[model samples]
Target: MDLDVFVAAHRAEWERLDQLLRRRRHLTGAETDELVTLYQRTATHLSQVQASAPDPALTSRLTTLVARARSAVVGARKSTWRDAAHFFTAGFPAACYRTRYWWVPTGIVFTLLVAVIGWWIAGNPEVQGAIAAPEEVREMTREGGAYETYYTESPAAAFSAQVWTNNAQVAAISLAFGALLGIPVVWVLLMNAVNVGVGVGLMAAAGRLDVFMGLILPHGLLELTAVFVAAGVGLRLGWTVIDPGRRTRRAALAQEGRAAIGMAIGLAAVLFVSGLIEGFVTPSGLPTWGRITIGIVAEAAFLVYVFVVGRRAYLAGETGDIVEADRAAEAPVAA
Candidate 1:
């Protein structure tokens, strides 16, 4: 076909592609193929026109087509409110629990965080030196660091606030960092574990272990558990590249990750509930017996969920199970 004739014939179709892509999704393969052909055809024509044709009219037409193509891509992106919510709720925790033996690695990371934090507080000369100072010196200053500052005041409020903030942070971090699927997720989970280990350890070493445990255990267990769930999502993403067992890395991660959706939302809900308890019920200086009871109850609930309820809730079942996983996995990529 003549260059000008082909360019003119495609002008209207390119504009239609841009408009149609912007307005709706789920385009049939034939329709999409047509759009792709229109784009490629226009691009080739523009290149030929630039190199050989000197017609002013053809140049203007090519410029217009280029704009339309860029616009079409923007129109193609699928950033809906539902996708984002689904990404957090369905994308993180479920993947974490589903990926085989996820907890084992998470536990190791958590323990290391705890030990590092504990050592920093108990042994390092700077910390030990401060703790050993006379009571009068302690009394004179109000500028305690994060750990110490929380120690002296209304621990209930501090602990409660920490639960809410940390839990939310874990969810956000998991979803955002899952894109790369590496240390960011691991580090986030490890950081939480370290915080928990050190925070609890300091209380014990200072002889306020009972008070700290009582205050923290009421909600900390739930909150931390949720955080681990988020980390699992990231782990799922990373394993796609690292292990990729069988069907290409992309294909495997996509499948396993898809199956993990429910758990992510469930974890977010757990974080929310944990925040509520920490805010309303847990308080610093609660009696030892009371703290123990709270810890026992919280731990019991977590165990129950992990062993019994979690299995049922996190797993796909009945109806839409396999189909839904495929849809969730493809939805983002399709966009």
Candidate 2:
């Protein structure tokens, strides 16, 4: 109730708290402890002042001091634009580069499967008939037909968003379900390969393989790569469940799972870029070579980013996991 006496009693403590806050980044352990204690006391004082004396200026000063001390004690872990930048530049690429062994082979295998399927379907009338009536197949593969018009069917912006959402979902599923022994991921990749193969087969049989290549390559190169990345990461996650090496299974899964989640986010952006190309460039008036060139450039840039930027970051000890300060504390285990 005696405001003057209270101010005199706590003035030194308030100043000390302020000083510690000003030097928070350089605080010794003892000083950090002192700051926490002072913060608690100052918060209590502010509460008492508000409920009792209600001194305008003193209450205001204590409120500000207490707020600063709370930040110092509790820390500000809110992510900012800087975190996003680091993830794209270092975390995402590092993850892709680190897991290249899994995904690179996945892409190769998937491509080969697609090619074999296409060859089988294009060469065999029975296989072609099994897919659809010959007439329907012919219609779909005809010039300016279903395959060519599919990209232009919707408004470009709407199509882009739709494509992005669909691809992002596929990528998310691949990454999220990897823990289920990666069976789902394999199935996903198979289904995608079949779909692409059907297109290739139909177009090749119709003597319009060029049309299919032109339409698909503009976005397929990057889009398929993203899917492969997700599938590979998912498979790795499944394998981690089987053989955790030096780490406990739980620890290894937790670490890889975090990186997979980050990859999901980063891959969403990658798919978005491909969606833009698919929606706009693929369907635009650009020459086929021009569209294909754009797609190749985008894919190449992504590879370079992974190998150059990502490799550098990984070598510098980045693991695509959350920074140590943000990671959950684990109980120490004997090696």
**lDDT for each of the candidates?**
0.57, 0.92
Among residues 3 or more apart in sequence or in different chains, the pairs in candidate 1 whose N, CA or C atoms overlap within 3 Å are 89-265, 90-261, 93-264, 94-260, 94-264, 95-260
Over 181-229, each residue of candidate 1 has an lDDT whose tens digit, in order, gives 6678877776666557655555555556555555566666666666665
The candidate scoring highest on lDDT is 2
TM-score of each: 0.55, 0.79
What is candidate 1's TM-score against the reference? Answer: 0.55
Model 2 pairs in collision: none
Displacement of the residue 181 alpha carbon in candidate 2, Å: 0.5
| RMSD versus native structure for model 1 | 9.6
Task: Write model 2 residue lDDT over 199-272, tens digit each, in one string.
Answer: 99889999999989999998999999999999999999999999988766767899999999999999999999
Off by over 4 Å in 2: 1-74
